[model samples]
Target: MTNNNNISLLTAILFFSILIPLFLSSPPSSSTVSTKTLVLPLKIQKPPIGFLSTSKASNSSNNKLSFRHNVTLTVSLTVGSPPQSVTMVLDTGSELSWLHCKKSPTLNSIYTPLSSSSYTSIPCSSPVCRTRTRDLPIPASCDSRKLCHVSVSYADASSLVGNLAYETFRIGSLTRPGTIFGCMDSGFSSNSDEDAKTTGLIGMNRGSLSFVTQMGFSKFSYCISGQDSSGVLLFGDEKFSWLGPLNYTPFVKISRPLPYFDRVAYSVQLEGIKVAGKLLPIPRSSFVPDHTGAGQTMVDSGTQFTFLLGPVYSALKTEFVRQTRGLATVFEDANFVFQGAMDLCYRVPPNRKGFSDFPAVSLVFTGAEMSVSGDRLLYRVQGMTGKGGDWVYCFTFGNSDLLGIEAFVIGHHHQQNVWMEFDLAKSRVGFAEVRCDLVSQRLGALGLNT
Candidate 1:
């Protein structure tokens, strides 16, 4: 069955909580960095049950489980000497990019560092190993074999441990020599392939340790799709012509120290949300920083659904239900239990005309508004009700407070077919509606056939 709950509760909240110093200092100048187009072929990952709603790339029988189609993004990478290609999740909220283990990789191989000629560990006494001033150095003899260690925890109490090390990293045909990363071997994973979604995590936050900063690129972008398992991850300046025009919102930096986590996520002033032509009753503060500068909202690619603060979500849902009450009808019987993360769902008419006739939803950022129409704003949750039920689509918006947190999370579910550009130099995030599958030609991956 399609797991009703996503793969892991932690999967929906890709937010990282780290308590160690990493091997990242100064990022090399973008001028010194060669501009390269690294194609990040995104895979549609299936979330485990109970909390999961996204779709998986697999075509197994479980496809009939939930009609709700929620999906997470992942990409393949070549790590270590002689290059071992491994598929990893592309996480914009995480800071450190790590591998599954220390081994030489095969098609299905674990990363065995002991077998790689290019393997070398950074010492425990290194500056990167020390998280804070006067902190004790990691327990090691200060030698090549003496590696610094780090532990990463998620909101669900699941955790992983790894040692800091440097190895050659390659994407497409582009190779970065001596890239710093974690050589991880163990974690709180239950099944062996349970880690298939994350043999490793490719970090894309603003921290110095992130894959984006380490590569010295001031900008990067990923276009995610709702229907297909394919999309594009672009790096450096996008001077391409095929991708059409863009809209932008300045990145917000109202500083508020999170309890035990660094403020490394990409935040924006989410002024308000609009349903149909009317604005929701929630205050802008519901999604913005307070006097303490905490609670500013961010958009994450790894998270599968859009999350709002509890009260803000209530206002949004109230307005949505008010506007879309008669647009589509579904079987809301005793057999139809609300198990998916998205609270608002409907059975699209067999003609599918109900979607086009439905009310619209839009998010007003400080500089621009992201207007989502019909099907794009909702997920077509397939079989959450059995084959006997009448349901076609489910809305993807939900309250994050229900999950015990309150950060406005704009996940991939809402970003489908949206071209998002993260320009660090301009300090803005640009969004536009485009078919993600067309991105290959937009990047000229297929040669100018259009």
Candidate 2:
């Protein structure tokens, strides 16, 4: 009896040790397991995830979500003796238009500054100028100083700083009176060299002091093409069928600056998936914001991928790994194990699903839910070594190891013609779709391979 009691005690200790942690970490579920417990790990460390305290602002009056697709625009820079054509990222999150300066002595190689004479400046005393400066955070020098000073700080610690100047800028066939742009004099050396390609960014998103907003077009809409084409940003009430039914979410005031050109928050509903006409449980989160350090949905067109936070990232990765247990081979690249390519000839285990048969991963935005159409879910990056050994894969979700922020990022190239509308009065956001083919042609003409 004594021996049996001792044995029983030891067994109980071991059982509880393993079981307690599993129960603590498991995600919320209706069913309970007798002996098994789920263990989910938290990702971010410093600032805890979730809502922070903030002051309440009046919700904007326009609360509907909608979009315009494939609207084209002509962007030019008047720096040299003759003007030059340049592509621009129309972003509402941002407040200024900037160009990559090739000849400005003070300009960084990553950013090209337009000539001083290329734009007209609003004096400090002007009423509109004061309002623009006050609302947009433009410097005091912009008041009386003909040249407007502007700066953009990115989540990756990269920044573009320059003087704000107004120049003749056109989008599609509609030419605005004059547009204010930032003549970039400095490059964000912290970012990769690829960030330097564009002439400048066009801030068209909500709350930004761009030409469109300053000119009083509060209800502007635009489109961006997909990876195959140059995207379009339009300002006006034009509508499109591709925008689908409008869903609007109130814009939550951000405690910190957002990853996009401006601070805008969105609420998305991910109706579970439909497999073979049957619905499967789909994950949903309300506060997922754009990943910082990555480019904005409106600007930084060079990035080819998007990122998500740790919880979502881990969930997706675990599911994919479990589904492709047999076909998945771990390849070491840059300190991470990537799922490598495999042939489908080998038979998969009865319990394990093959990679080839994995269901498509869909991302639902306000306007549409896009599915991954390719065989491979990860986009493999060429290894730094010439031997093609240490390749890196694009992360679909998680904090960017490079950016160090807890957010989701949508690359501009992948989400062209997707319109983001911000209504300050209504405190709501909207989305729409656009055509990407013509945008692609324009990008090709400018040596940009989408």
Candidate 3:
């Protein structure tokens, strides 16, 4: 028994002795950094309830869940020393990357730092720990072990708590070493079933701690496909071969210090909104931010539905309802809001095939206009009076006041079939209409299938 114990101790020592060199060795230069462009494939995964028209990654699989009114856009990446695969939601509204630790409740696969030779915990005294929460409202705390810990809480009340650490992240052929992320041991979600499928989230915002900013990438682009197809994600400045004509809009910077407003999010200017080729009566000031930086418009892929500021949304909805009064019966039940947010529902007659006659809604921005037409304007919500094959279609736009947020958010639902380029170098965003599935195929052909 003593001989066996000696042998076990020696084996443990030998394992570390062999791996010590690897831990000290510098990582390979990231392909995302060296290459002019890095492309990663993305796919759309349906939720449990199937299709509710909720506005919404990755190799061959990326799932976005609309459960509990939270829409998440996910991507697949490998992490750690030997590299374990992890599913992370791509959130432009947030500024931090994180992963679920082994102690999480769900039986899904999680990151086990102890098994990773390259995982390095940030000490409480480290500068990285001190400024980790610079862009976030939450502050970093130190545990009894003197390890830097962070707690992240989203707008939906989903929270994650864990130690701050550095690990290697590999996306497609690119590898980013010593990337800082939260190794969350505890997580709380509004819906466990849907959240269980994903390990954590990857923040792609403009903050200092964001993945794109940390990796030193000046530009990134993504094409979000429709419900039935895949898409593509690209990092760096090199343009893709298939990219078409794109309209550009400069990013607006809010220098005003506002405690409640989100400064890290991508903000864009809104000139006006048009419905059925007619402009609404809302004043231009309604779209502008106040002294506190409230009422800014952001393009966030994390949110499933588009949310306009209270007055702006009201004006748009009023104009929209007036335009389509006789086409379909208005669903006027105030208590029957679909998913507790979308209230402008209409019951279409079974004889009518689809809402083809619905007027197109266009969001006019500075130097750019996004047109939402046909099925994209209205979502066919499931389980809404199925008698006689009559379908219920609800307007995709919602009020941001319902979420207690003062800003206008352009969600994932409206980004489908659009090539969106977030250019950091020029401080501008570019958008163009194209088939995202074709983009996905092109990326897959480039050997980014996994």
Better of 1 and 3 by TM-score: 3
Task: Report the Cα lDDT for candidate 1.
Answer: 0.61
Alpha-carbon RMSD of each model? 6.4, 20.5, 11.7
Cα-based lDDT for every prediction: 0.61, 0.35, 0.67
Candidate 2 matches the true fold with a TM-score of 0.54
Please provide TM-scores, in order, for all candidate models, with all chains considered together: 0.80, 0.54, 0.86
Q: Write one digit per residue (lDDT tens) for candidate 1, span 108-218.
A: 446778766676676676676654212111221233457677666554344567777777677765666666777776676422333544557777867666778777788
Q: Which stretches of candidate 2 lie over 4 Å from their true place?
A: 1-84, 90-92, 101-118, 122-147, 187-196, 211-304, 337-358, 364-370, 373-376, 383-392, 400-402, 413-450
TM-score of 1: 0.80
Error of 1 at 100 (Å): 0.3
Q: What tens digits encode model 3's per-residue C-alpha lDDT throughout 190-261?
A: 666666777877778777667887677888888888755467788877656678789998888867656545
Best by lDDT, which number? Answer: 3
How would you encode candidate 2's per-residue C-alpha lDDT over 223-320 as one tens digit per residue? Answer: 44434333333334434444565455444444655333234222233333332233334454322334441222221122234444444444555565
Q: Which regions of candidate 3 fall more than 4 Å away from where they truly are?
A: 1-32, 49-71, 103-107, 349-352, 386-389, 445-450
Better of 1 and 2 by TM-score: 1
Ranked by TM-score from best down, the candidates are 3, 1, 2
Instruction: Tell me which of candidates 2 and 3 scores higher on TM-score.
Output: 3
